[model samples]
Target: MARGEPVTVEPVVGEPAAVADLGGERALLVADVHAGIEVGLRYERGVELDSRADARRERLCDLIRETDADRLVVLGDLAHRIGAPDGDEREELAALIRAVTDRVPMTLVEGNHDAGVAEAFADELDVIGADGGVLDGTVAACHGHTWPAPALLDADVVCTGHEHPQVRLEDAVGGSRVERAWLRGDLDPAAFTEAGTEADLPDDPPELVVFPAFNERSGGTWVNVEGQSFLAPYLPAALPAADAYLLDGTRLGEYRRV
Candidate 1:
């Protein structure tokens, strides 16, 4: 693929989602869909709630249809928990993955929470490295928990998802709400060069796009607030002037930690 060729990245409307239209390599990118989170809520937080696995599966299927994507790239955390999946969790995850894969190809970039996932989904899908994977051989993606492999930094654009970025909005009545938001900015090429990979960066450096958690129940970082720590390793160095946008393509401008 030509490095100079422009690819279109847009947010999927009527939902908290995004997609990168790479011509024949079109893909829908979503992050941090912590399947079986309801299990955690019940067991850990002691909250009684119905399982949302069916709802999540339907939401994902609908988004896939809307985007008309040939492939689905999950940024990471395809399942909850740090260890192996239990019977209930495995069933929910398997069902969701089966539902999507039955329609189109799926790739799960390993996330911090994705341990034992490779074995779990071995027959259904190929679980890629935590370091990241290249989409359409152009855009590089990682789950944002660790330093990405040097190879992943050489793509036209870098995408990551571990942050689950969100912005805080307060109304006149002193009530505040946090909504999922997409974070977009350019990376500094000099940083890559300084790391002794000067030739790896393109003449025009790639932009960085951080995806919000796809699971609605997953709590997110208050990105626009003061003293909020960023979780991604490359984030502090990239110093992304993160512009927050809703899924409807409404631009909220640059959101900086206060």
Candidate 2:
């Protein structure tokens, strides 16, 4: 509940989720919901997908109720499509939103995948733009896929859900496993210089926090690897060095980079 400390909750295996305790009021923070992920996979990539949307929603709702959080902060990628929400997806998303909003304040931080869909649910939710906005106690939430705005950098603590950071842990069989993780580190000031956005760099890099993607289909952009540009800025040795927190339900631990 204190600064730099997150009370962790472990969800079932294969269920991607996490919660952050913010003092008296807890924050049910989830990322990359990608509401219509199955539809996108099917229509765009020709992959037959099955998403347990109902079950997942119910589980998430149960968690929220259990935590007694004052609000739910969806980090980003609430919707999968860029333009419109399909029939089934729209209904499911609406139902899910309604179910949560009925109980507590639900805020959405727009992600790249959440363009027009926000307007569709504007009446039912408080949707923040890419620039994001501040909440209680220096807490700023945003979808971390894009460059952060100057204002966000000035917040006491910045939280985002882009990059879907994951760490590779090998099983006994030597097979690799990837679990959704949170990257907690200071903002890299050098990233701006590298991207030629030095003029935009903040006087000081704020404490950086990256939430894991809530959508199961969305893994992570492997940092520490070459030719993978999506998460280059968040990588260590970059301006604002970041650390990784691998989340498996209530169990949260430091992710050792290999």
Candidate 3:
């Protein structure tokens, strides 16, 4: 495949990661890593916990090797500090970045918590705006806190994070549990008109893929739970008739109805 041709992005079964064929180079796509999350929990909520930074970094490295990805694209929130990185957070991030970049080139899409990381490690990664950037001139990747770049809206497909989407399920016995999910739908060209983007709406809109967070410690909105709301401002409204799927790839028609 070449630039402008249809790109391939397939979710890795049972994991919140995807393999994207960036023309001929494969890239691993992950989002909402929230590294050093224990630090944030300790600071913001007065909760103390052990750092899973090592496990998180190793998981990513394993994915890169297993997928044979030529590059790695972090959709957003690679760090947990909402403002700036320092202390244990900075150290963990440094190690994580080094580990991934050592294996393959990496791109970090700016999420709400990533500004400081971008500024601090500008030399180690290809840090793009939170609005997102096109990969291999085909696949579009964004953080989803805001609308994607207009050009990204015109790609073969658009993928994002920030929702950390999960669905609550109930058994016949009334036991319930939450599972992270993938939300996908057709892009509504009319949706971006309000965001003030001048994207040339394609005659046939591309698929809009909402990825789940890679960090299990990151609790997210229970999409199917009543009174729970979507985090992305443009979601639910922008993605009409969106469907939710489990990490195992079981499709539960219509995320709203799941």
All candidates: CA RMSD in angstroms? 2.5, 4.2, 2.2
Local error of candidate 3 at residue 97 (angstroms)? 0.5
What tens-digit string does per-residue lDDT give for candidate 2 at 1-258? 123443243232444554555556677778788887777778888988777788767877987887667888888888887776768778878888988888888888888888877788888888888867766546777776566555665455677777787666667899987666666666665552335553555555566666667776776776544455565243444324455555543333444444
- How many residue pairs clash (N, CA or C atoms closer than 3 angstroms) in each of the candidate models, in the order given? 0, 12, 0
| Model 1 per-residue lDDT tens digits across residues 1-258 | 236676556678756667886547678888999999888677777988789899999999988898888888888899987788887888899899999999988889999988998887788776779888777666888898887776765677888899988889889999998888888887765552335543555566677888889888888888888878888866656744657887677788987742
Candidates in order, TM-scores: namely 0.91, 0.80, 0.95
| Better structure of 1 and 2 per TM-score | 1
Q: Model 2 misses residue 112 by how many Å?
A: 0.9
The lDDT for every candidate, in the order shown, is 0.80, 0.67, 0.87
The lDDT, on a scale of 0 to 1, for candidate 1 is: 0.80
List the candidate numbers ranked by TM-score, top first: 3, 1, 2
Regarding lDDT, does 2 or 3 come out ahead?
3
Query: C-alpha displacement of 158 in model 3, angstroms?
Result: 0.2
lDDT of 2: 0.67
> Which regions in candidate 1 have their CA more than 4 angstroms from the true location?
1-3, 189-203
